[model samples]
Target chain A: MNLAQLQQAFRRWLVNASDESAQLLGSNHVGLAVYQNNYRAQLVGCLEQAFPNLRRWLGEQAFLAASITHIDNHPPHAWTLDAYPEGFHATLKDVFPQNPDVHELAWIESALNEAFVAADAQPLALEALAELDWDTAVLQLTPSLRCHDLTTNAEAIWSALWQETCAPEAVMLEQAGGLLVWRRQFTSRLRQVDALELQAVQQVQADGSFAGLCEFLVQRLGEDAGVMQAGEYLAAWLGSELIVGVRDV
Target chain B: MSTSNPHFSGYGLGLRKEHYCDFLETSVPVDFVEVISENFMVAGGQPRHILRQVRERYPVALHGVSMSIGTAEGLDTDYLRRLKSLVDEIEPLFVSDHLSWSRSGGFNAHDLLPVPYTDEALDRVCANIHQAQDVLGRTMLFENPSSYLAFEGACMTEWEFITAMARRTGCELLLDVNNVFVSASNHGFDALAFLDGIPAERVRQVHLAGHSQGRDILIDSHDSPVCTGVWELYARAMQRLGPVATMIERDDEIPPLAELLQELSMARTLGAAL
Candidate 1:
């Protein structure tokens, strides 16, 4: 066979050592077995690195088994091992339908990884936000900012595992809420978001100008109270450096 | 490829996160440092920040593991683009990757998977190398990988395949002596003959690392110090190919900076003795 055909057959054999491939392997089949073992070990090692907290939460055996399954289904497409095991949380959900928290933990970990390498931008100062014309100004957020709505208490589990302390017992969320993740300088930070903040974040993401934001507030609260709440939320966002720029719309 | 060798030459070590601060704080006595190309392919992060700072003090060689040059489907142009951007930024002394395929069917196995030493495989590899050199506008060094298995219908030896590749593509060679020793021992071939087969002028860099012995075979696990047998082989290579860029690599179970420096010092002593 030619090189292309040989590579195709070898790829299949690596994934599953079938009888035909075994015969084609010819002498020193044990060497082929070593390649197979190294193939699995290296990929599993990459998954463990990408999701250390998830591995800790799941324990060694369960994590290794699940990662092996994930590898079979969704091999890495990117060149870097840092980018391996993408969409693993969805796989986790498939593997463990009863433990929804496992999937949530994976999501949180993945977002943190993203935040670590996201683009850099100097955040717009809080004082700058106050000077903007509330009626015409459009706020721009940091590019690294990410929000996720989850129904499990995954953040607590992540924090505990990260600290290397006794991890907290897993629990379901009382109500569906979300988390806010963004890079503050070189460090990535995560915090829980309430319903009001989630709605405001959604508005900002959907291209809500200051006027639209005040209107969103006025519709939720009375005109006077809405104006006050808008000011407070804007102040909080600017103070956190989540707001990176502003331009007049 | 440049007919001239690298201007800088001395013992070097693989840069790791544990030794990042060590490199930044004080000038490590090593002459140059090598880094994995994929780790620093980021837009903005501490890793890039650290690399920028570290590059100021020492020359770096970008060693890559995922080019998948032997794949029949084709090379990943996107990966090459990212790599070119990094090469432009780092201005490394050498840019190198393995002569093995890591990607097939749109999925990367992340290991240096071996390739058949047939004429067809050699053609594809030379084409990929030529294309990569054209895209980056710089010559690349292709390293030999430690193999656990050989194809049933290979047409030539590994050294023959590499020598032909270098002669045809005008690409230099990264002679991984530890990998030579590993593959030689695993496949029951003479390491000296493998070295003698290669045209020495094409060899631009040499890699020395450690391996582990499994029940039936040896694995190229670069976690420990260079073994005595590999060290003896390295001494032989130094005599045949002089003044090549050499490095001591340790990926897993990394020791302290001092231990690696000591190992690197041993390399210098051996080379000088020869």
Candidate 2:
């Protein structure tokens, strides 16, 4: 037989195998069944890791069903399972439209995985700040550090997942809050942040000189929000090792 | 980093997640460790950190299941990139992947699917291997996967195909002794002849694993201890091939480190005898 017929036979056997009565070697069928099932299972298991939130929101059966369906049309082209789930959200959103939370949940979960493997680096500590001359010191977050200004209460929902009790209402935070995800000491952590503080850090990180930051905040949040309060927030972030470095003056 | 020779990292066992803690807490005399590259390919994690610690001590060799050299769809680039990154990080003594393909198009069965030994198939496999070696910038090794079936179109014996692949592609062979036993049993081939036909220079590494029998066929299940027949094959392969880098794969029903070492020690003895 030529390679084409050989390829066809292998492909057919992979799809479905018959018993040994009609087979040249009975063992090939067994290997195909077990190997095929495990191969599909690897992708499904990777989806569980990449989209834990979607998995939780959709529950076990529905989530696995969605995963199984997605993989059927989009068998993994890459050997690394990490990249395979990169396109999962688009597929899930199309399949489960009525469940709008699915998109947000998938987004948060994917971002969480992203943050989890961002890079290996150290975050700035408060001690690093103490040595800085405050007037000229411009704090810079680590490259691995990212603050997600979310539109949905992803944090609360994720927190509820940790308790092994997942209820949507449990995450009924007043506003769609902001989130900060950063990797330090090779561990990833995420948390909700206040809106004013979120924008405050983002603005400074984008292009705020310390004095300019205070002036901008005075104009935007009213003079009643003192510069010291902003400094305190910065200090708190620094203490938690969220602030990684300081830009040159 | 501790230096390693491609042909010999002394005696090592397949790095099992089960015995990770054992290796971490205390150091044993095992010379090196083999890891399934797919398991620890991601950017960062406890798994990687542990792997880092392990690499600092023992020589690490990458054994991948997804290279799919036997497939007709050409080489998978994404898989090669990931494997390259792993090679950069781990610096395994000699990188190896299965001589099998698991998918074509979109349907990925994730099994170490067998490839037929036809001339066309051989050409594709050689081209893919050459492409893979070029990308990896190193001579890669391919293992003969345990088979469940043999197509009628087999142009030559499995050994003939592997030897031709190695010779054609400038790749090395990872002589999986257990696979020989399993395939020989399932397909009624002589395992010793399978060893005899392959050029010894091509075998840079050797694998010894355990297998279990199903209702009608024997499965290359890496569970339990290495069967007596597989041991005999290992001794024969080592005798013919001389001392090659040897390791054991115990993925299922993993025993304690001591037990695995006991088996590895026996291999060390066989390696020494050879």
Candidate 3:
């Protein structure tokens, strides 16, 4: 057989590992299921690693069934299987339209992955602020700090799951929400944020001065809203490593 | 940590994630390290970060498992770009991939699949290797893979296929001794004859690893320690081929670095004694 024919045969044998393929293996089709089982299991495991939140929400049985079917349709295009789940959330959205949170959860998972492997840079030191002209300086995030604006509390659900908090249901208190997925020391951490807080973070990220950000939020939320209470908020953000780098706009 | 010298320390193991903690915690005298090119290509997480740190400490060899050298479609440009980016960052001692093909029609099987032995295949593989070398800006080494089955229309032996590839492209051979043994046992061919077919001067590096046996054939698992028979084959090949840079590749069932170093040290001893 030519190289293409042989590879095509092998591909047929692989997908139909659990089931059977039509004359793909020539004469020796027996015991191929064992190899097929192992291949499918490993691929599924890779997806689980990529989308732990999806896997948790779907559970093992449902996750495996859905994932195996997905792989059958879209076998990995790259040698790196880690990148396969990049668009899985959209796929799940198509499969389960009623559950928008499931699809949103996939976005959170993909965002967290980007945060984990994002480029390493020097996070802003507490002392750097003292050096910066606070009036003119813009507070930029770590550049690796990622936040996906979603329509449900999927981030909170994902965060809870990471903390081993049960209740994998669609009982989101907040309907319109965003997720904060960022690398805090050695690992990725996720949390849910409101639309106002999401905009506040983005303001800082988009080269808006911290004072300007506070003014923008106050304009949106009202004077009574203490969104600019920098003492507690900055302390919390710095402690959580939710910000990185400082530059002048 | 020195980026000035591109040469790796000579003896290193495949940097797998399961052994990352062990590698960081303990400091062995391993000369350099080899990384699976596709593993960290676009992958992030702890593995990618740790890979950067490891690159700081040791020279790395970017070894790939799925270049699909023998594919009928020939080289894939997109995959080559990713590999080139990795080489630019890691600055590895050498960039090598399997002589086997793991992809066809863009369906990446993600396995070190075997290729049929035909003049058509040999020419395609040689052309692909030359193209790879041109893109990578260095000579590449091709590793022989363990086979579970063989193609019925093979025109030449596996060894002849390999040597002819080298002759066709001016590329080097990796000469995976364990794969020779595994494929030989599976197809009932003389492993020594397979080794003899390759040109010795073209051998830039050698790979000595372990294999697992099945009810009917052997699998190049790279999980266990190098078996007695494979080691014997390695020694026999080294005696004739002379010493070459060798690494221990264990993707599954990875043990302690010290344990692998023990096997690596033995290779050093064998390569030097030759």
Candidate 4:
């Protein structure tokens, strides 16, 4: 085989371990076995490292099974190993169809990983906000911020697992909320927020106007409470370093 | 493409996360530290923050594993761009990758897959090197990788391919001594001949690491202390490629920083004798 053809065959051998591809490469079974083992082992190690809390949550055997299934279905295409775990939630969804907790836990772990490495931005100083036009001002969130809808207490489970405490049993939340992950300075932070706060944050992310967020909350929670809640969330987000910039639209 | 890289003779260690506090908080008695370029290639956060702090203390080298120069298709521009942004910031002592292919056909294996030592493969690697050098605006050091398999090909030896690649592309060489020993043991080739064949002046850096004995092959596992056999080979290498920048690379089962520094001192003692 030529160069491209040879590489394609190697890819096949690594991804599938097919005998045909191996034969085409020549009689090197011992060597090919080494490569095959290295390929799968490296990927397994990547998943294991990326989702340590997920591994603990699912137990060892179940997590390994899920990882194997994911590896079998999805051959990696990204240039960096960090991108490999981004698709693992899909596999978790398929493997644990009844367990939304597992899916959300995976989402939480993956989002935290992404937020840890997302682009750096300076938090907007509270002094800068003093001169802003609330009506036409646009608020820019930190690039590292990631938000996801939540239906289960995966956040609590993840937190307990992280702290090495006895995790509470997974259960469906009476009122679903949201999970937010972002970096403050050098530390990645995760927070579980109420549904209203989640919606307000998402609306602000989409629209980025103080008035727009106020209007969004006003429709959800009457005018007086809505505006008050908006100011509260703004103070909380600013304290958490989530708001990176404020610009006049 | 720039071929000549200024030579610096010093002993250093691969800066892994395990010893980040040791390197950042206290003054490690090493001339330089090498970091995995891909690890710091991210957009932001603690990895970059820690690297910046470390960079302030010691001269750093950017050692990458994802630059699959042996790919038959071509180079990855996005990877190069991210790497260039980092290079501009760190101004690393040396930027290097392996003479192996981890990516092809848009599927990355994330392991250093072997490259057939054929004339066609040589040409392709040279072209890729040229592209990478042109993009980074600096010559890169390509190291010899440990291999478990050797293809049945109609071409020259590994060193011959490397010699031709350096000559044609104006790139430097990162002579991985442990890789040479591992590949030689696995493929049943004369390690000395492989060493004697490469251009000594072109070599700018050296890597000494530990390996494991597999069922039928020696794996470049880099987990244990540097073995006697590899150390002997490194001594021989230093005798030939005098005063080259050398470092100990421990990736898995990392021990305390003091143990690695002790191993690095072995390299220093050997280099001082040379």
Candidate 5:
């Protein structure tokens, strides 16, 4: 066989040792176990790294079984293991249909990792924001910022696990809300945001104009109340270094 | 075994993340430090920050595992571009990858898979190496892989492939001695014969790592200190290719910096004795 044909056969055998391509792997069938083991073990280890808290919640045996299933279904298409675990959240949902919080926990953890290395940009100075015309100024968020709307109490469990405290029991919260994850300096930070704040942040992110943000707030509340709410959110975002820039729209 | 590349000569260690602060805080006695290229290929993060600081203190060697040099689809220009960007920043003393392929079709397996030693495989790998050299504007070093199985195809041996690749592409070789020992034990080939087959002049660096003893094969786990047998083989390698840069690799279960330094000191002592 040629190089391409041999590689194709090897890849096929990796997924399934009983494949017809096994003929090309030579008569030493036992040796094929090494390649198969490495492939599965490396991928499973990647999933574990991507979702440590989830692993603790699900227990090692269950986590490993689910991760193996995920590997069999979605062998990484990316060059680095860093990009391989994005599909694990979907896999967790599939395996734990009754426990939806597992999916949310895995996603929040993955988002934290993504936020840590997404990109680097200077946060807009709070003093500089006062000089801009609020109506025309377009506010930009830090490149490392990520927001997610979650329905489960996964945020509480994730926080406790991250802090090495006694993790609270996973449960569905009465009210659904959103979480904002962003990098401050070198560390990644996340917190739960109220429903109204989530909507306002989403609007500012989409349109990026303070005037539009004010309008979004006004639609949610009255004119005076909306303007005050916008000011409070802006203060929080600035303090968190989530807002990166402001310029004329 | 008459000629040897005189560029780099000293003991070194693989720069793992656990030892980044150790590297930045104090001056380790090693001459150079080798880093896995993929680990630092990020936009902005602590890995990049630590690497920049380490680069200022030590000569860095960019050893990559995802080059997939033996892939039939061809080299990934995007991956190469990122590698070149890093190379431009660090100005690594040497850049290298394995002789094995890591990707097939669109999916990347990430682990280094062994390549069959045949004229067809040789032609493809040589071409890939040539392309890599052209893109990076520097000579590339290809390391020998640890193998678990030999193919059914009747062809040349691994060292013959390495020799031919170096001659054709003008690329240097990273003679991984532990891999040679592991493959020789598993495939029933003479490890010394494998070493003698390669042209010593093309050897630019040597890798020394530990392996796990399995029931039927030795796995290149790189989680322990160098074994007596591998170290003996490394001594033989040093006798053949004098003054080659060497490093101790520990990918898993990495011990304290002092422990690795002790092993590296052995390399220095043994190389000096030779």
Candidate 6:
């Protein structure tokens, strides 16, 4: 085989380890076995490292089974191994279809991993907010911020697992909320927010106007409480360093 | 071929996360620290932050694992751009990857897969190297990788291909002694001939790593201390390539900083002897 053809064959051997691809390469079986072993082991190790909390949550055998299934279905296409773990939540969902908690926990780990390495941005200083007109001002969130609708008590489980404490049993929340992950300075932070705050953040993210957020909240809550909640969320987000930029639109 | 990279002689260690506190908080007695370029190639956060702090203390080298220069298709421009941005920032002592392919046909294996030493493979590798060098605006170094399999090839030896590659592209060489020993043992080639064959002047850096013995092959695992056989080869290598920048590369089952420093001192003593 030529260079491209040879590489394609090698890829097949690594991804599938089929007998045909091995024979086509015409290399030693012992050598090919070594390559195959290395390929799978490296990928397994990547998943294990990326989702340590997920591994703990699922227990060892179940996690390994899920990881193997993921590997079989999805051969990595990215240059960095960090990108490999981004799609693992889908695998978790497929494996544990009934367990929303597993999926949320996977999402938490993936979001935290992404946020840890996400682009650096300076949080908008509170002094900068003094000059902005609320009607026309646009607020920019940190690039590292990630959000997802959370239906289970995955946050508690994650925190407990992280602290090496006995984790509480997973249960569906009476009122579903949202999970927000972002980095503050050099540390990645996670917070569980109520549905109203989630909607407000989503509103600002969609339109970035303080007035638009107030309007959206006003329709949800009454005018007085809506505007008050907007102001409170702004203060909390700013204090948490989620607001990174402000611009006059 | 004349290389743009200048020669430096010193001993260092691969800066892994296990010893980040040791390197950042205290003064580690090493000439330079080598970091995996891909690890710090992210957009931001603590990885970059810690690297910045470490860069302030020691001259760092950017050792990458994902370049995949031997891929038949071409180079990855996005990878090159990120690496160039890092190079511009860190001004690393050397930027290097392996003479192996981990990516091809848009599927990345993330392991240092072997490349056949054929004319076609050589041409693709040289072209890829030229592209990478052009994009980075610096001469790159390519290291010899450990291999479990040798292809049914028509053309050249590993060192011969490397010599021609360096001659064609004017790129420098990162002589990995442990890889040489491992591949030699696995493929039943003369390690000394492989060592003597490469152009010494083109070699700018040396890597001394540990390997594990597999069922029938020696695996370049890089998990333990340098074995006696590999150390002896490194001593022989020092005699030929005098005063090259050498470092002890340990990747897994990492020992304490003191243990690594002690291993590095052995390299220092050998260099001093030379």
- Writing each residue's lDDT as its tens digit, candidate 4 over A1-249 gives 788999999999999999899998885998999999999999999999989999999999999999999999899998899999999999998999999999999988899899999999999988997878899999999999999999999999999999999999999999999999999988889999999988888988897999999998899889999999999999999999999999998
Judging by DockQ, tell me the better candidate of 2 and 4: 4
DockQ (C-alpha based) per candidate is 0.68, 0.34, 0.37, 0.89, 0.72, 0.89
By summed lDDT, which 10 consecutive residues of candidate 5 chain A come out lowest? A22-31
Q: Model 3: number of clashes?
A: 2
TM-score of each: 0.95, 0.81, 0.83, 0.99, 0.97, 0.99
For A1-249, candidate 6 gives per-residue lDDT tens digits of 899998899999999988888987885899999989998999999999989988999999999999999999999999999999989988888899999999999999999999999999999988898878899999999999999999999999999999999999999999999999999998999999988888888888887999899899899989999899889999999999999999988
Runs of candidate 6 with Cα error greater than 4 angstroms are B1-3
lDDT ranking of the models: 6, 4, 5, 1, 2, 3
Clash total of candidate 5: 0
lDDT for model 5? 0.88
Q: If both were scored by TM-score, which would come out higher, candidate 2 or candidate 4?
A: 4
Q: Model 1 over residues A108-179: C-alpha lDDT tens digits?
A: 788888888888889886577556677898888888888888777888889889999888888888888888
Q: Which candidate model has the greater TM-score, 3 or 5?
A: 5
RMSD of each candidate? 2.0, 4.9, 4.4, 0.9, 2.3, 1.1
The reply for model 1, stretches above 4 Å from the true place, is: A126-131, B1-5
TM-score of 3: 0.83
Model 4 chain A lDDT-worst window of ten: A125-134
* Alpha-carbon lDDT of model 4: 0.93
> Which CAPRI quality tier does the interface of model 2 achieve?
acceptable
Per residue, candidate 3 scores C-alpha lDDT tens digits across A2-21 of: 66776787777786542334
Clashes of 2: 5
Full ranking by DockQ: 4, 6, 5, 1, 3, 2
lDDT tens digits by residue: candidate 2, B1-274: 1122266737789888788877778887787789988877776656688899999888888888877787787767877887889898787888889888866764445668778787888899988888888888888889999987676657799999988887788788888999999899988999999999998887888889999987677888898899898888888888898877888899888988889999998899887886
Q: After superposing the true interface residues, what Cα RMSD does each candidate give?
A: 1.7, 3.6, 2.9, 0.7, 1.1, 0.7
